[model samples]
Target: MSLPFLILYFYLMNFIYNILVHIAYGIIHFLSLFNQKLQLFIKGRKETFKKLSVIQSTDKTIWIHTASLGEFEQGRPIIESLKNTYPTHKIIVTFFSPSGYEIRKNYALADVICYLPFDTKKNMQNFVRAIQPELAIIVKYEFWPNLLSQLKKEGIKTILVSGIFREKQLFFKPYGKWMRSFLTAFDHLFVQNENSKKLLNTINYNNVTVSGDTRFDRVYEILQQDNTLDFINEFKYNTYTVVAGSTWKEGEELLVNYINEHASENEKFIIAPHTINSKKINELRNSILKKTILYSERNQVDLKEYQVFIIDTIGLLTKVYSYANAAYVGGGLLTGLHNILEPATFGIPVVFGGNNYTKFQEANDLIRLKGSKAITNQHEFNSIFTTLKQDVNVRTTMGKTCGDYVKNNTGATQLILNYINNLFQ
Candidate 1:
């Protein structure tokens, strides 16, 4: 309100904007080096309005934003819902990262898919003005202050879908006063759990609902599709299989160590590491004393000769779980957590690192149902794996428990669709 305070506020805002602009500049350079296509790809999005002028669409669009590939996967069910429910509505999708945009740019449901321009005030204003969406849905944890403020200024009906929150986050921190303003910009937030709702309530932003997670819906859909891999089928024949899906180095180390020490004659192991780079694959092979086969180099695989089959590829981890008797979803052992719902949908028991049960709701549910276990070290891993392997009855029971957990948590997509329809109606 006062002249001095107003000037100070403006100065701080400008300073922050400059920092973001520099960060954006660095990101642009980084993306350009690895792939020229990515460079040319995002160069166009920097001025999306000029590009969109050629499309000649007079209809209002429903815009959705996702941070990366995982969020896009979570939002896939919502996209399918929109197609079935509101066939006439035009849809636009945007991603902030190359990992998201690159993977799903060819998505059939979305009318347009591109990188969301940097969150500069001008870019946000230009984007909002060009698209003029009737409704906007933001997925997961991505929040850009400039974009949110601009959307609020334009009176857009914005909502956060499959939302999550944690106490350690800046929004709940006492000193995060300026950061808290971003939460108020949303008209509604469809949170995944009670923890998120409580966190939002603490900030006086209570337009929130507990809608569960949409990824369960997506993973369930995968099971309905044809899941037979010709090469994989020959490899998993009539053997007690332990699938390590989305594994990192830490997980692989733990698993390799356990398998080497125990040496079960009836059991076979499959590993799908998160990074399938040649160096990493070779390292994994060298780590194991057993004869290992890489998926990339060979076509047909024999299950009997080589007990360990290393999946040195991507996009096959989820499908491979269909053939698994038990699975270990990776990421928690190191730093990040992998997708647990993928393995659970196949009705297989899952194991992971102890650090991950915090953010993963399905992991918690499976643990409650006695379908999954979280182990901190090799001893616990050996004990849990051995128990599940030896006793077929225990494996069958735990598998049922995991399947029930997935079945119970399947309606988040429907709830989100209902909320969106009510707003339009």
Candidate 2:
């Protein structure tokens, strides 16, 4: 293709893309009238720009973008490390989802945390002009063409961290030329695995490195911190404990049935549902036949009388994993799987429903190393649960395997920091 024709082609494609973005924005606004989550999403951005207006522009600004809470967790270690190394520079974190902003809005490491403005050309240009970041880091798979284009036009260094690319992704398809152009806008991509590097290579993207996932480094740091819970220690006093973290309806049903049918007096179960809303908590409590107590009501009730404990609070799941002989991380049976690395870092064998394992390489790796199990139904859950509960040797071996996996995958944060340092030099 001639250079003039290629320029016209990209201009037309971008025009179409902007039209689609505006249409999606309109649809979201229409749905906000009926959907509470959508209402929060719109309201969050309104407040976001209001907050952004107050942050005085600084030349030493570092902007990091994440899609949601999960991506924030993946990018958090690097944010903290950069803050320490460049104390004079201001750190700004932007989230595309309300969930991430709402949870980490008060995050101490970041000088400012706000929702990323919509990816319109004007919005991107204005946002970049206001922040004037020295460098921009995007987490995981959030690719905004308008934002990247604006960053490139401003000559700001940009990179993607913890990136995982697959052959089936839009960028690798025959019709993905425009999307492939967005990858070229990135100065570098620090991918999680060699498979991602190979896939990017197929598209002639050479500014890539296999830096592994940063979540491992984050979880390992948690392991070193003070993760003690006195109430949990009291509950698990000498018994074998199974800590089910971030479980959903399907996971809860299977686990409750297993406990009722096969659990012994010496074993205890702790369930932390994904949501702690009273209705969900009541429904979970009613479904289980075993004597259960809520974490909120732990002080009022005798902890020893209950065979099951339901965690009805937030910010405690990761710490609770330290008390587990085995762990069942949830979300696998429904849409996707929650973090398996949390329990793995605690040196516990993890089990989850076998639903979506493609995005989570850690789960597949753990399964291969005999450190985790993914089951479909109650029958399969029962078999795996029974084996881990009965055999001490098998459980110990699997726990060590899980811990080893986490230890081996550390240092992606350092690799990313090294790259950033060289960029500044």
Model 1 per-residue lDDT at 378: 91
Q: Write the per-residue lDDT of candidate 1 for residues 1-425, one digit (tens) a residue.
A: 68798678656865786588879768876988787656855674765565455334477678899887789989989988897788877788888876567668778998778788777778789788778888999998788887888899899999999998889888888767667877777989999999899988988888999998989899988879999887777776688899998788888889999888885877888899876678888988898887678887555545457778989866788789998999998888667677888888888888899875567777777787789899889999999999889988888888888877778888999998898899889
The TM-scores, one per candidate, come to 0.89, 0.97
Pairs that collide in candidate 1 are none
Taking every candidate in turn, the Cα RMSD to the unseen true structure, in Å, is: 3.1, 1.4
Which digits, one per residue and each the tens of the lDDT, describe model 2 over residues 49-145? 6766766754479999999888999999999999999998889999998767777889999988988988999999989988888899999988899
Q: Could you tell me which residue pairs clash in candidate 2?
A: none
